[model samples]
Target: MLSWLAEQRIQEAMRNGEFADLPGHGKPLELEDLSGVPEELRMSFKIMKNAGILPEELTLRAECVTLEELLAACRNSGNANSSEQKSLESKLSLKRLRLQQLLRERGLENSSIFTEYGDQIRQRLSGQE
Candidate 1:
């Protein structure tokens, strides 16, 4: 709805000579529901949170960057850089956020995955369980 409205506004502004260059109309995007993510992945999210991000804001979607990817992104620079570890922390944190987001949407998960993960999951979710 916002995208359509923005488009209309842009068109009107152009017709009225009220605008020459348009600011970003912004990319149209749908907020994905992460509630359906598998239990294992959510556990991974918890792992990320343990590393430091607030889980609630990130959501449980696996679409977020993974630990492996973070390592690679960090390594893209020829020389091994200490900053890579820090980047890993940020990625893990976001993944945890996704997990927390999913947990909230599901209204509290009682999956065995959490049981298996045990303390690690709890620690990451900020005592959300």
Candidate 2:
């Protein structure tokens, strides 16, 4: 069989020291920890990660976080402009809605995406002491 031939060839190479000068010859193979990823999409996720492309949910979530931070800063600043704060808040709300829709499509409709971000914006704004 092909595997047997491959094993024979590999043994012959080892006896001939073909692997001696290879990098990391004596070290353990560094295995990737992929326990968290679903079995079917692991390869796709790996390919996307290697190509520096984030999933839509992650990208949207990051935008939401940035908008939230900007809104918070605008509120805290003494000379905060109302128009800019309103625009940032609008953007944040839209992004959150998009993220929620994505979660729903992914069958996570019952779970709150904003919960990952802790208190909602209204709670933070109204509960300020």
Please tell me which predicted candidate would have the highest lDDT against the true structure.
2
Per-model C-alpha RMSD: 13.2, 7.4
lDDT of 1 by residue, 1-129 (tens): 999999999899889977545564455555543354455466666577568764443333322434645576667867767876777777777777766666667655566544344344334445345
lDDT of 2 at 38: 52
Off by over 4 Å in 2: 1-41, 110-129
lDDT of 2 by residue, 1-129 (tens): 999999999999999999999999899998876554456657986899889997787677667767887888998999999999999989988998998898789765464543432234334344442
Pairs in clash, predicted candidate 2: none
Please, what's the RMSD in Å of model 1?
Answer: 13.2
Give residue 83's lDDT in candidate 2 (0 to 100): 99
Task: Report the error of model 2 at residue 89, Å.
Answer: 0.6
Per-model lDDT: 0.58, 0.74
Per-model TM-score on C-alpha atoms:
0.29, 0.58
Error of 1 at 77 (Å): 11
